[model samples]
Target: MPDAKQMVECPVAAMLELIGGKWKPVILYFLGSGTRRFGEIAVRIPTISRKVLTQQLKELEHDKLIMRKQYKEIPPRVEYSLTDLGESLSPVLAEMSIWGKKNVLEKR
Candidate 1:
C-alpha cells in the first residue's frame, strides 16, 4: 500500500492506485454482467495474460470490490462476482459509457 502522504497528495490518484490498470477496468466490466469463473473471464478478456489476470483478481478481492467463491469437488471450482461495493460502481461505468458514445463515438 502507498503511504498516507501519497494519498493525501492526490485523492483521485489514491483511488486509481486501487483500480487503475490495463486490465482491472476490463475485469470489472465483465463481472458487472454476472458471476463468472476465472477461466470464463480469461477467455472473454483474451488480451490479459493469465498471470496478470490472477494478480488483478487478487487485488480486486483484497479491495472488497469482488467476492470469490470456491467449490470443493474432484476439480476445484471458483467463481467471482461483484460485491455490494462493486455494484455501486456500475452506475459510474454506465455513465462513462454513455458519455463516451456521445462525445467519442459521435465525434468519429
Candidate 2:
C-alpha cells in the first residue's frame, strides 16, 4: 500500500479511505453471506444503478477486499466473495449495522 501511504498516514482515516463510500459498505455486507453474481448483488441492492455497482465492485477488488472470478460460459459468468481480510471486517460491519439500526434508524 505504498500508494496509500503517500495519501494517508492515520490508520483509521486510511481504513475509511479504503472502504468508505455510499455503496461499498453495503456491497461488502451483502457479500459476507457467500459468493454472489453481479445480478444477485444488483437485485439485493436495487436502488444502486448497474454502472455504479460495477464501479464499486472494481474498486473493492482493486483494494484486495473482495475477489472477482470470471468463468467461461456462453453469456460470461462472474462471481464475488470476500477475501480473508474482507471476512475479517464482518464483526465491524455487523456492529455498524446494529448501530445504524438502533441508534440511527430508530431515531428517525
For each candidate, the alpha-carbon lDDT, in order, equals 0.89, 0.94
Error of 2 at 1 (Å): 27
TM-scores for candidates 1 onward, in order: 0.82, 0.90
On the 0 to 100 scale, the lDDT of residue 40 in model 2 is 100
Model 2, 71-105: lDDT tens digits are 99989999999999999888889999999999999
> Compared to the true structure, candidate 1 yields what TM-score?
0.82
RMSD to the hidden true structure, all candidates: 4.1, 4.4
Shift of residue 4 alpha carbon in model 1, Å: 12
Model 2, position 21, has a per-residue lDDT of 91
lDDT of 1 by residue, 1-108 (tens): 869887778877766777788888778878999999999999999988999999999999999999999998869999999999988878877776789889999999
Q: Which 10-residue span in candidate 1 carries the lowest summed lDDT?
A: 10-19
Of the candidates shown, which would achieve the greatest lDDT relative to the real structure? 2
